[model samples]
Target: MSTTEQLELDPAEVQAFAGRAVADAATWMATTMTMFGDRLGLWRALADSRPVTSPELAARTGTDERYLREWLAAMTAHGYLTHDPGAGTYLLPPAHVPVLATESPAHIGGLHQALYGLTGMLDRVLAVFRTGGGVPINAYPRDWFEGLERFSAGWFDHLLPQVWLPTLPELEAALRRGADVADIGCGRGRALIRLAERYPAGRYTGFDVHPESIAAAEAAARAAGVADRVRFECLDVSGGLPGDYDVITTFDVVHDAADPRGILAAIHAALRPDGRYLCLDINSSHRLEDNRGPVAAYFYGVSVLYCMTTSLAHGGAGLGTCGFPEHTARELCTAAGFGTVRRVEMENPFNILYEITH
Candidate 1:
């Protein structure tokens, strides 16, 4: 037999094997969710002081060490736990608990539960796609909102105030000089409302297509006592961004758009001469190498599956082609008549800080 023919395997069989493996791996992610016991503080109890054996941890935390040991083994394999055979102890580090403990804003234990729901959503994706109908971004029930609010309010809120805020010094400076600012596709307008509160002199507008979200945003602005300076509009940015603003900001919005370029152009038009355009979104595709580490990759997959791609399919403009890199963003800005474009690091992890000049 020819060398090529001899070395070739059955493509169908190979593909079938790989397909099942992938499915099983995804299922494993959901299965891991069932063991939320460790996430809920069981591991923390074990690692609290000197490393304790599983039986002692179980007694301390009022759990069954037998099953707890199994959980520990799983977590150990996942690197969330360190097993010391010499001491017969299991430990979870502080780094692992920051995202697990409910008290912290970065607590991602709730999101881990959300991932289980996304798995179910994945099961329904094909049917929804076939019908060409989409589940709303608000499809999840009220409890999901409660969970998300806990996750988002803490994570995103902290991120914006610390990271994204500093990146806006130039825009803030322009706005202090009396420039209108619009945060297009602002969901709930948390960031926009905050900016409005800070820059009392600047007009702040938030645009989003979901009426429900817009209402919530307006209410939030009112509650924040910036209703006078802040306004919420229910509109699709794909239609076009309104112009004459000194600064326009889009946070985590571009990657979820079906037509990013249209919005980019619209934002360009909306800017005053020499205005600044700020974009903040996940640094996917562009910085995949820098971001492809395990934890980041996992969330990126979740965003693409449940957030980005689903947003487009759900009767909304989809994030097209996972968005452009920093250079690509700069090029797009230049193409849109922006004279200069720069990227900076925002407080948000793996977030792109775009500074474009018109």
Candidate 2:
């Protein structure tokens, strides 16, 4: 409708929706600013470390004070930083350390970086909207993959050791007794490396279609000192896996695969009898109505930005981010000839872990 063509509207509803729209737009732009803070080491400098004046931060970080001043002020306005009018310094609250400053599982910096990198392909993604193709995964900037590594570092470092493994006695025992494990779509190999480091008996393989990721994984494995037992290979499991394995894992990967069902079936065939498949996927509902909320919104956004597009780019089934919900997971696993499909008991809001066997 034209601007001149006014329709009857509820004033309260209009105002509320308008406010939400503006806030969301502001948050979207703030993500880029957050990337700047992360890349420029501003967050680290203020992360429960010390309060600093804009000039002081500029001097410490080798950045211009003019930009730093505006950035500091913006952060303060956004509640990421608190302004001290008396001293003209800004402080990052200790409470915000996990979400902003640190490089832990709780850190939000990775999300910022990932989003920034992914959105950089807006022109290409927009083109795909009209042309019906997608931006290739390799086309994405290094920051996207690095951001993903950082984001996943939290799960592999903290939860995988502490919660994911400990809860599964059989899998844990298998690892302890030298299980041959493959982590498909293993990205940078951090997860496999972490497991190799923790469970020395397990021989781990990291697989990915991306050559750069495979190389990076190899380097990471070497750096982590797990190179002896851990290896990284550039492989597309949608074709077939190399060997039979006691345990197979795909952490936050299936939905992004161009051929998830085929990969799952290959995984099923590749696993030894009585072997377990540990599948970590997005925790989502099959029905759209049940999937309402900001969390689901973010999931869809990332799917469009990276997951779905990459899969589509490869001419595979675009399962997107939340495409494989719990119900869908069960269906896919059952179709892949898995005898058992049980959702692992984990109190995670963002992901669901499954135990599958033939």
Candidate 3:
């Protein structure tokens, strides 16, 4: 027998590991319940309201009383809601209001939805693991894309105009002076649409591999009354960018590419001599030893389930989600023929922004 097999199992260690597994499982279930509550408007109905029976909440949200009661019971048991046993009523604490309300900037309910959506692809991910292949981006259900877009909207809405753009005065000046801008891997084009509205003088174009996303982006541009200034196309940017843009932005896209290097090279070639490139990627450490926290764990899980798999599907280098650290980013930019790479001074929990010049 192997040395590991010959070793005796310690009951205490086994119990501790099992206990952690149980806790993790409970957390997963709680997240699913959170998603359900968010999707059904249960949380919103309970927000800023007095403690009341599930029937009252059901009436407020136009849902079935019986179902709502069961859901409320589950939530109460999980400590997501407080139960008044004497009064037979439930309450969503005021402190939890911001985190659950859809319109609130502190809302993290979309993360639960995203986790649920990602778990739905477990079977496909398992098949890929065994067969040395992967599922394509478009193969996943629409909910995954919707959840991602919803989660990203808060950051883009709150940061782009207020914090991100203002940090770079030169880029802002060029943009104001009617520069041509391109957004690569612009899923649904939220950022592009926002930029178009903020800088009407600058012509904006968005490129995405998924036809549905490009179509949706085009529709959004039209709805926002910037269709004439902003356009979207369905194309793989790793092959080549279509225009010599004065500015190019890639938000959380490089590590997920089939050929990140190729995309970088294409961007370098497509940029004007004095143009700038902005890349927002996951904030991570290059070494595994330095990545020992909840955020890192979450990122690794996402990389395995989505980012790495999608890249592998295209026979591309799977950089995983945490593969592009600051050092690695600088190296890649230099190799791609960028003249300068500067890490923008911005504090965000999830991402790091870099400004590149050629």
Name the candidate that leads on lDDT.
2
Residues 1-358, model 3: lDDT tens digits: 9997899989899999999999889887877888889888888888875798977788889999988888898888898899998999999888888888655557887676777688789999999999986788988776777778778887778787888889999999998999899999999999989988888999999999998888888888899999999999999988899879999999999989989999999999999999999999999989999888788998999998999999999898999999888988999999999989999998777899999998
Please give the CA lDDT of all the candidate structures.
0.68, 0.89, 0.88
The segments of candidate 3 whose C-alpha lies over 4 angstroms from its true place after superposition are 1-11
TM-score leaderboard ranking: 2, 3, 1
Q: What TM-score does candidate 3 get on C-alpha atoms?
A: 0.94
Candidate 2, residues 1-358, lDDT tens digits: the string is: 8764686778899899999999998887677678899989888888765778888889888999999999887777787788989999898888889888887778878777887688688888888989987888899898899888988889999999998888899999999999999999999999999999888998999899899999999898888888999998898988889989999999999989999999999999999997999999999998989888899999998888889999999898998898999889989999999989988898988999998999
Which pairs of residues have clashing backbones in candidate 2? 258-317
Shift of residue 194 alpha carbon in model 2, Å: 0.5
Candidate 1 lDDT over 1-358, as tens digits, reads 8987888789999899999889779657634643365345674464353577888877888877788788777767766677899988877676766656444666665565555456556745566666655555656443333344445666356665666656668766776676688988777778777776666888888898667778888888888899988998988776677657888888767766656777888888888887788777666555556556555666566655555555666555554334565756766667777787777754445466777786
Cα lDDT for residue 262, model 3? 95
Could you tell me the lDDT of residue 167 within candidate 3? 94
Indicate whether candidate 1 or candidate 3 has the larger lDDT: 3
Q: Which stretch of 10 consecutive residues in model 2 shows the poorest summed lDDT?
A: 1-10
TM-score of 1: 0.68
lDDT of 2 at 239: 80
The TM-scores, one per candidate, come to 0.68, 0.97, 0.94
Pairwise lDDT winner, candidates 1 and 2: 2
| Candidate 2 ranges with C-alpha deviation above 4 Å | 1-7
